[model samples]
Target: MKCALVLCSLSFLYSQICHSANIVAFMPSPFYSHQIAFKPLWLALAKRGHKITLIQPNVIVENNENITHIVLNGTYDILDKYNHVHSLVEGQSVMKVLYAALEAVMEGLEYQLTHPGVQELLKGEKKVDLFFTEFLLTFGFSLGRSLNAPMIGVVSMDTTIEGHMSAGNPTHPVMYPDRDMPYPLPLTLKERMLNTLHWLVDRVMNEIFLNLQDRVASKCLGQQIPLNDIIKNVSLVFINANPLFNVVRPLGPKTVNIGGGVHLMEPQPLPTELQDYLDNARNGVIYFSLGSTISSKHLSNTTKEVILKTFSQLPHDILWKFDEEIVSKPKNMKIMRWTPQQDLLRHKNIKLFITQGGLQSVEEAIFNYVPMIVLPFFGDQHNNAEKMVARGFGLTLDHNKLDVRTFRSAILEVINNPKYRERTKESADLVMDQPMSGLEKAVWWTEYVLRHGQTDHFRNTLSDIPWYQFLLLDVILCFLVITVIVAYVSFKLLQLLKCLAYKLYGKLTRKIKTKIN
Candidate 1:
């Protein structure tokens, strides 16, 4: 009996050991927001007894035994590149801005790949069970292939048209606009036409840029693998998008929506000074931030003057995230270089969020039931703002047309309006009512992919079909050809029958005439 019990215990221990995996997550994007969105997934994996080696730009995960942080040097300067690009491309077309951004990303990827740590890993000394990385960067896929591990792509923002296309997710531009366009749904004919054009332009541009990345990546790997094949073969994609803020669209079987995953955790305690300020606010407080990427100090002088002047008129106290101190700031306002945004939003005294509509900021606001006054600058910020307005819980303002009068009035209107607050609270409740937290769902799916190996079963059939066949264009042409042939044959047969009848009638008439004579 003792021997049998010992054997069973050993077997159980071995099974548990088998379940644990060595996951290497390569997120070399220089954008801090992307790192913020990806942190929860890596942390959750670390908590679940899996060993993680995260190659990130700005974040460091300290004091975790299961996780090793590999910070890439010389990558932090990407923030400067972002600021320069934003300044240069203020009024440029979305495609142009996207191209500029992608060029920077490619540069960042090249820098990361050249890092000593990354070079060692690529040399195949480490035994990796799973490889995870951002989906937007095509070069990262090569690392997974190099390690001979299953790859899982993570989208740090809402699903993009490129991602949907790559994953074989159904896309209807008429109903679902491109990620760059901010037009509301139930699109007009003109809007639909523009939306279609935007989709095509984006798709073509992505292919060109991605092919370039693939070439660079191929050279680095010392092997030639087609980028398209790598993308299609990814075991799964975990997206930080939910139906609440995202347009309802078909998702592929391997595409997992883990929206609001990072915000699912309880917020940490606010700093003492911020807590005191919020506690003392009798008329409530408005928190304003442009997110981590965009610096408030970079705003033009006129813009800054208008914003400050507008905030002075508001009855509510304001907390602005500014990198530099304002010498003549309003007495009712406070400026902080940084504050715990999630913690500040959780405070009961907080009334509204004035933001740039980054996905992380929007998700945090929605989770905390705070309405927003959005002034979007670029990328998906515009689209996010539009969705918030469509949901009836927020309003959008044009930063270019922003003046003191307009800014002040918008703030007052949102503050005085009870419906916005009510609707936002309702949305928060609905969003939080999911069966499991986003983290839990993410971890479950990650392990599922690990246990089951490649997700061939999860791939959509549409992925394999050509566009002509998927759209039934060929089928439609065949049906039209058959109809035309049948119609022509029937018309000819009818004409022949008519001639025969006429001839028969003529014959009958002659026979009758002869009989009468």
Candidate 2:
């Protein structure tokens, strides 16, 4: 009897500790920057005792036991397969690649529905408990349906109109962190026109791809699919932006702004040579990196020489994150293939950051409060850079004008400007003061959906209302039309009465004159 009681107690304890539910986070693009943005969230969950799986093509993890990293090999090679895409030289924007990759993934999914690899993964032996992913990639929705689990979308950018509309939030360019409307509730005529134009562009893009997505999803899932409806049912959204970078606005529990979730790991000691160079230089250090995907080695020799020559003139110590090992690194310059970015950025002596303005780098600078000299290439980088410039935090450089003179001037401006440093510090302070770490907030809300197992809260929220209903413009237009009709009729009646009265007076005067004569 004693043995049986002990066994029973052990069994119950094991079950209680096993919140070790299965989760899969899907990112459509194979970009390293996007992956970095999500790394903290996955790592945090894995630490808390969850069985985690990250699915993408060519993904690498630092190798933790609690998490499983799965790479979908062939499906992701579309980045290289499209030769035209590779040949297209973009400066600093990533939008084109983002859009192209999304199209390719959707196409790949369609192809994979018939392929063995995708089929086997989707047909896993165990059911997934939660599906977490970037909302821009629609595959997570299908995965949620496949596993019958709740979905938590990780937004890679600020909540634009499309993002808000998809999440059932109000449609306006309000500051996300505080959820405050920067402008009036009812947009002015000019605002309405611009908003409509932006909305139309998004509508056109979404419409063009609907048929393609449907066909791809159906072929992959082995049945008919409702891509539109799946997007409509996301349970939670985690935006990768903090309130510090944005104006304060109201946000719901489901849509958490967990910006700066990228874990700022501590720095390891610098390599001896780089340390020696920095030690010798009396001036401060400057870090230059174009992010992960674009290899610095890919730059033409002329551009490389120009950059080198420009840095040679700067009295400051330089650490360049270059792809290839240089034949001769300068006495004051250190070229490294990789560095502990967050760790190095946190160093007090590091004065300036030359970045591609990718969201990950942007968030890091915001987290560390480091001043930036951005060279944006494409997509939201342009927008992100624009915001940084608008906020007085950084200087934007055109990639085409990367001549020595221009580069040197840009670097000098940021280094000299005390205001930029002050603003960056302010942003850092705001980012650090969040109520909960992004990981905790993300995990708690994800579990909340699992425990509840329904969408009652989201369903009742105003986000569920259709765009027409949310705007209430239809009702407003009807009221305006009725008011116009009533005013018009009243004016017509008054005009008619005045004309009749004048005619009567004239007739009476004529009769009196004739009688007197």
Best by TM-score: 1
Tell me the spans in candidate 2 whose CA falls farther than 4 Å from its real position: 1-18, 83-88, 91-105, 109-117, 173-196, 222-225, 266-282, 298-302, 325-331, 416-418, 494-517
TM-score of 1: 0.87
Residues 248-316 of candidate 1 have per-residue lDDT tens digits of 677878898887645445668888888999999999999999998778887777888899898888889
Question: RMSD per prediction, one decimal?
Answer: 3.7, 5.3
Q: How well does model 2 score by local distance difference test? A: 0.69
Best by lDDT: 1
- Please state the error at residue 122 of candidate 2 in Å: 2.7
Name the regions of candidate 1 deviating beyond 4 angstroms: 1-18, 76-84, 88-99, 175-187, 479-517
> Each candidate: what lDDT?
0.81, 0.69
lDDT of 2 by residue, 1-517 (tens): 9999999999877644536678877775567777667676677778878888777665556778877766666664666765324443443246666666666766666554445544676777888788877776565577667777788888765565555566766554322211222233356767556556566566567656655767666666744667667766778777866554444455654577766644444357876766665566578899999887666776667777888888888989899998788885566688888887876776677789988777778777767778998876655666667667867788998765679998898899898888898998886776677678776676677667655655647742555565565657789999999999999999999999999999999999999999999
